[model samples]
Target chain A: MSYRIEELLITTLAPMLEGLEHVAVGAASPIPGAAALLARHRGGGRPRVSMLASRRHASFTDGARELFDCAAQGRIDAFFLGGGQIDGSANINLVGIDGYPASRVRFPGSFGSAFMYFVVPRVILFSLEHSRRVMVPRVDFVSAPGTSPSNVYRPGGPYALVTSRCVFRFDRDRGRFALASVHPGQTLEDIREQTGFDFDVPARIEQTPAPGAQDLVLIRGPVGKDISETYPDFARRVLELDAATA
Target chain B: MTNLETLVEAIHDGASVALAPDYSGCAMAAVRALVRRGARDLRLIAVPQAGFQADMLIGAGCVGSVEAAAITLGEYGFAPRFTDAVKNGRITLRDSTCPAIHAGLQAAEKGVPFMPLRGILGSDLLTHRDDWKVIENPFSPDDAIVALPAIRPDVALFHAASADRHGNVWIGVRRELMLMAHAAHRTLVTVETVVDDDLLADEARAAGTIPALYVSAIAEVREGAWPIGLAGRYPADAAHLAEYARLARTAAGFERYLDEHVRGRASAA
Candidate 1:
């Protein structure tokens, strides 16, 4: 049986968030938000989830100011980031493509990405589209760089890069990504052909784990309902929860 | 003095102006008025991030520089005008992160030279910024962090749910507006209503209010945060924003939009 790509993504990110105290999901992120809620549901709410746009999920009263302060104080453990383009070195470009001031393609300006990428210990780089255009040889501009010098006093960085096709673990020391697992429907060659950047491949690649039966039940049931409050369309489309039914 | 245009005239060309972020109380009425007044070359600072207000201003050619973490329309997608401007090298882009902006504004509020921030250790933002410095913490030489310069602005502008006759504005949990007001030389506000009742008499309400001393001008404009909406008062006009996104794709369409909505409406004002 084939599981949905979103299901696989949720399961993949859940483990990364294990034993974390808190995980924050920014606006416009549905998969990561669902995964954070799923992790909380599975772990008996061990890792508190903070959804930037959701009233129920957010605890702070001061909005982005509080969110920024919490990240600065090292209260948030995990965060999700996406870019217009991402490179082998884990550099992301949230700004436009081509150059700083001039570009052909433009994305939304960099929000709390650079700040959170530095402060959050386990920053997961995710993107739904894993094509060569997105996963680039080098990002046009670095919105938040993956690594810094040893003397930079950095405690946080890209822990892993998860895409629809595969999962790659970021090696800070080597400043390169290592192929971890190929998604169920994809082959290593498929990843290689689509990826713009080079990466290290192990002798044996594992299949990305699928969501368990029980996990699916939680995902389809209460978790689906919980996320609907924040991501209505995602819940309706991905989980097949209709407005009347949900 | 109570007129929107008169209030907008207080802000001059090439002035550094700070505005609240998307989720905060956005003064769309005042923003429209500013566009009408042909305010140009403003260094518009988003408390952290902004959406349509920034996009519309950028499109109207009323801004010279934008300093923010991001300019987006949230689920609706990239801010088209802002995107186009950045792509064409038309505006000064001060790419920043959330905490850096907040800390810089806070530094200005406290009359400090600079404020040390926790992160930016590995970010390209640090490398790009000339104003930011990385210093070994004298408290702990082992620890190094980024220090941001003060971001004192010429004016701070926003909309509020209500303001009292005394000019104290009730902002509730949107405390960043207070920081913006404190850090700027002049704070101009547009409120949904100006109540005669004194808000300071109630300690609970007073705690959330920006006292009149910091407020330079207050204009009573009903439904002030139109199209974007005021928190707890009204919701954003999603259909209108969607229409805006659709039409704002082309320069001609954007101009048409400006004429129909912004320029046209301002003429009526």
Candidate 2:
């Protein structure tokens, strides 16, 4: 029994690591960044891990405001994003990109996701917290398309959806995604029950791996106190979801 | 102990400082006052390296440009061309800028790890820095890390709405002033009116912000946000901005304006 965040990072994201040529990570995306960096370190140059603000932090070499243009045009290899609002179609809206009333939801505004989604062949999404409010049937807006390849997305759309509960895969043709597998100890019915919309849950799901002690140390070290500071709401979510980012 | 007179005397005699948010608050006025008192040599730092106050400093020959393309802002935000401002004029843009970088000295003085960032990597800025180094994460052998060096200034300057005889100050609404006082090696707090000490203390009490220990000096002066844009506090005087825009189009033009306004004026007196 390992911490949920540790498991999600080490087992789920770690094993998924293939030899991506170059990957772009966006805002609130320290998990994938850490995961990729960890994998390449543990797995040996698996992929060139990068971030949307790589230049800002000092580790990134290719600093482009528009990830889709460069990624679609073969500037980068993969991208990672999160959806505050996702629908059955896999389309996501971080928050309403449309004019906000200033009363309700306040997301930090979309940062070039449209172009990135339409271009990158490999897209991985991780939800810091998963809930019915997050995994909805339809997004409030479309920052990036989730399903494509039918000329709708000339290149591709989201390849995988990593949630707190389960991992999802999309049909390359139909564009509707199905449950790739539920995490270890979780049932397809469990995932279905928690989701906001009806979805095709496969009978088979895999158990996610927990991060080892060494992995946990690495995961928590670079983050410093900034993790809890940045995600103050994590205390509430951690108790509710019974998950940990290690 | 350096009182207001000694500190203002030092600033008047040419001290380098960074002016946060509103044209270093009243450092310009303090500098002018110093000039009237026969003190000289004042340099200051402003963000958006190409803006009007920045131009005026260059015009007055007080500051040339930011020492490095990047200075920390406690909580203000980032300027996209920060790296480009020093790097061969090639600016790569980013997306998240939080307007806190203008409060760099504040965080240093306040003793914080990292302030929030607004815009940095969401633009073409990233493309320009392929030559920049990317290294393995220091703690995580498997992860990567980017090295951001520390930023420290020689002197800090800012203005507040009011100050007491003891040099305790209060700036309404704007927190950028507090940030400047904290970050500089030598600091100056200039104000329009010398108010009651309790009133300034009450203002800080309301905000629950930094104490006066962070500020090194204070001088009473008016029109502190002059020749600089201060939204809602004072008018920016767009005509002045446009005029500065013309003079600051190049380094040579900026130098001439500084010579005429700053050096020439000093020579005349």
Instruction: Provide backbone clash counts, one per model.
Output: 1, 44
Q: Which 10 consecutive positions of candidate 2 chain A have the poorest summed lDDT?
A: A56-65
lDDT of 1 by residue, B1-269 (tens): 27788888899999988988777888888888888788899899988888888998899899999999888888788888998898888998888888889999999999998999876666667777888998889987778878899999999999998999888999988888998999999999999888889989999999899999999999888888888877789988989989999888788999998888887897444
Best by lDDT: 1
Per-model TM values vs. the true structure: 0.95, 0.44
Instruction: Assign candidate 1 its CAPRI class.
Output: medium
Fraction of native Cα contacts reproduced by each candidate: 0.80, 0.00
Off by over 4 Å in 2: A53-69, A97-103, A212-246, B1-269
| Number of the top TM-score candidate | 1
Model 1 Cα shift for residue B217 (angstroms): 1.5
